[model samples]
Target: MSEKKNEGNSVSRRSFLRNGALAAAGFMIVPRHVLGRGFVAPSDRLRVAAVGVGGKGYGDITSFAEGRADIAFLCDVDKRRAAKAITTFPKAKFYTDYREMFEKERKNFDAVSVSTPDHQHAVAAMAAMQLGKHVYVQKPLTHDIYEARKLTEAAKKYKVVTQMGNQGASGDGVRQLMEWYNAGLIGDVHTVYVWTDRPVWPQGVAWPQTNATIPAELNWDLWLGTAPKKNFVDNLVPFNWRGWWDYGTGALGDMGCHLIEPPFRVLGLGYPSSVEASVGSVYVGEFNRGYFPESCPPSSHVTMKFPVKGGKEVTMHWMDGGIQPERPEELGPNEMMGDGGNGVIFVGTKGKMMCGTYGINPRLLPTSRNAEVNVPQTIARVPEGHYLQWVNAAIAGYNSKEAKSLSSPFDIAGPLTESILMGNLAIRSYDYREAKIDGKGYNYPGRYIKLLWDGPNMKITNFDPANQFVKRTYREGWSLGV
Candidate 1:
C-alpha cells in the first residue's frame, strides 16, 4: 500500500507557488499548470481530506488519490482502519478524531469525503461544508428525514459543490431509465415495488455474544460521538451497526435511497400522503420505540402513498428480510434474477422495468412481447466507475457533463429521502395504536390521510403536531448550520 507518486510528472516549483498563492487568496486553483502539457488541465486540483478512512471511506480516498488530488489528511475512529489507509497515502496526516482533524487541518483541504455510518454522516458532512469545503457524503444522505432536509439547505447556503454517495446515480443504466420514462416507455407508471435482502448480513435477530475486548487502538467513545455512550460490543462495530437505531437506519434507510431513486425521478413523484410500517417485535415493544439503547426494529414491511405532482397517486411498497415480490410471468422461463442483494421493480400500465442496486444492466419485463420494444439510445454514457467520477469532479471543480446528466440533484434527492424516511415514521406511528390521529385529533386508521406538504418549511399543514419528528436536536457544539 505504498504511496504511488507520478515521478517525472511532478509539478514545477514556480507553478506550485502560483497555485498555492491562488488557493491562499481563496481563488480557484486549476490543475493545468501542475500536470503540465499532454495531461488534461482540469479546472482545479482539489486538496481533499477523507473523514472516515475505512470501509467505503478507503475506496473514496484512493479514488481521489488516483485523480492526482492531494490527500491532505485521513481521519477515523479506529486506529487499525486508519493505519490501513495511511499506508496507502503515507504523506497524508492521520487522526482518530475527525473534529480534531478538521480543527487542525481544515485550511489544508478544499473538500472532504464522508463515508461514515448513517448516524454520523450529517454531522461530518455539515462540518466540512461549514468550513467552506465541498463534500461527497455516502448514500441515504442522512439517518433521518430532518437531517436530509438540513444537509440540502446547508449545501445551498454554503454555495459549495456537493454530491451524494449514491454512486449508482452516475451509471448509464439510470440515465437510460430516465430516457425511457420520459419517452413514456413504461406508460404512465402508477406503482413501484422496491425490495432488498439486506442486513443479508443478518439483522432484527438476536445479538451475538461479545467475547472479544475492545481493541486498544480504537477510541470507542469518540466513535460513538453524539450517539448515547455505550460499551464496545463486538457485533456492533464495523458493519453490523446497520441493525441498531443508534448507529444506522436498519434496512429501509440503508437501501431505500438507491432502490427508489429511479421511480421517484422518472415519475416526478412528490411527497407521500401517508406511510405505515409492519415489523416483527424483537428489540423493542413498539415499532417506533422513541429511540433505544441496544438494537433496531426487526425485519419490517413498510408501505408509502405518494400523491404525484399531478392528480395521480403512487403506492410504494418496501420489503426486506428475504421478502420478495411475486416473480413476473412476463420474464422468460429461462431468465433468472441476477445475483444481487438489492433492486427495484417498477410496475407500470404497460409493463415493468427492473434496476439492480448498483444500477447495473436494468431489464424490461414482458421478455417475449417486449423483445422488440424500442429503448432510446443514450447520448452520453458514464464510464463504468463510481469513485473515479467523484475524484475527477473534485479535481475539475465541476462534475463531468455525463455525471450531471445522470445523477439526481437536491430537487429529486430531497423528496426521495423524505418519502423513504416516512416509512420509518410510519413504523413509529404503527406502534402508537391501530387508530391513526390527524392534526385535529381525528382517528382514521387503515385509510390514506391526505397530508399537504410545504417542503420549504418541512411541514404538513394537516399534521402540525407531527412536525417535530421531521428533525432532531443536535448535541451542543455539534450542530450543523449556515
Candidate 2:
C-alpha cells in the first residue's frame, strides 16, 4: 500500500454518523436489539477479513465462519502456513500484507480478525478500528502496556465491538466461579496462584549465530512487522517466536490470558498496583550463565499486588516454565492440582477454590465440597462460545447490548492485559544493568525492586529505566496512529 492509501481515509463510520451523513440519506438504521436476537438476515451476516490466516489464525476464522460470518479476505506472510485457510475459503481474497488488504478491501469487509504475532496485534487491530471495523484480536491483547491501553481507548473512540481471543472468558466455568464467589462460597479472595507449563519451545538460549536462508514463500521482512529487522532464523517461524521478546510475550503471554481470566473476573481485579519477579537461570559451562536477554527466561515467578475493596490487597502469583506453587493441604496428594499442567488457585478468607486452564473443572478445596456446594447461577453463559460471540456482536453493531456484554471486550481485556503484561515488564527489568561508577563491571539497580505502578498514567513511579518496556517504537512505515 502506498503512503497516500495508508494515511488517507481518516474519517471513520462513527465520524460519518456524527456528521449526520446517514441521517441526510433519509434512511434510519435500526438497533440490533429491536430486530430481535439471532435474527440476522442472510445478507446481513458479518463479512470478515482475517490477518495471519494460518495456524491459530485459521482456527480463529474457521470459528468465526461457524458462527455465521462470511470469510471474505485472508492475509498472511507465509503462504505455506496459510495454504489450508486459502483452500478452505476458496473464494476469499488473499494478500500477504494486511495493510494492502485493509487499504484495497476496506469496504468489502465489516470486521477483521487478527491472529498475528503479539507485537503486531496492536497495530493491526488499531487500523481496523480506525476504519470503524469491529476487531477480535488474539490475546495478551498487545505486546506492551501502552498498546493495550491505547487499543482499549480506540475501541470506545471508534465505537467498535472488540474481543480478545481469550476464549476462557466465555466459558461456563468462569461464570460458575463468579457465581460461587458472589454467593460467598469463597470469601474475599486474598491470594491467587496461576501456573502454566509452557515454552515447550526453546528459551533461555542465545540467538542463532548464523543467518539462515529465508524461505521463498515467506515474506521475511513483512513477517518482522513492527519487530526489529533481523535475519530469518530457522525454527523461529510459525510457533517458536513465542519465546522471543521481539515477536512474542513468552509463556506468560501464551497462557496467562487463559489461566488468569478466572480469578480476574471472580475477584473483580483491575490494574496491579505493584509488580516484582524472579527468574530461573540456565548454566552453559561450569561457571558461565546462559543469560540471553533477547529470549524469555526458562522459568519465572511474578508477584503482583492489586488493590481490592476495603483497602485490602490481593496477591497474585504467576508461574511459568514448569514452576508451580506449593500444594494445598486440603487436597489429597494423589489428586491433581490444576490438570497437572496448568491451573489457578484462589485463597479466600474463609476457604480456597481452584480450576484448571480455561477455568475448567473448578472445585472448592477438599474437592468433596463440589458435590455439596450449591450456589445459584447468577451470571449467564456463552453457549455459542467466544468466536461466535464476537461475530454476532459485530453483526449487532457498535454500542448495542450484545457489544456491551462481551466476555472479554477491550474495556475489560485491556486492563487485564495491561496487568498481565506488567508481569512481563518486571521480568524484563530483572535483567536491567548499567556500568558501575568504577567502569569495571555492571550494577543491576532495577533488579529486586518492586515496580511502583501509576496505572492511569502508565508509568513506573519508582523505576525510570523499566518504563522503557511500557511502549516500543515500531519500525519505520508502521504506526499505531495514536
TM-score of each: 0.81, 0.91
Between which residue pairs do clashes occur in model 1? Answer: 199-202
- Provide the overall lDDT of each model, using Cα atoms, as 2-decimal numbers: 0.67, 0.86
- Give a tens-digit lDDT track for model 2, residues 277-357: 988878777655556778898999999999999999999999999999999999898999998989999999888999999
For candidate 1, lDDT tens digit of each residue in 376-432? Answer: 675456574556665565455434453354255444566678787777655544223
Model 1 ranges off by over 4 Å: 1-43, 205-213, 282-294, 337-341, 398-411, 430-456, 460-468
Pairs of residues clashing in candidate 2: none
Stretches > 4 Å off in candidate 2? 1-43, 430-444
Residue 162 alpha-carbon offset, candidate 2, angstroms:
0.4
Among the numbered candidates, top lDDT falls to: 2
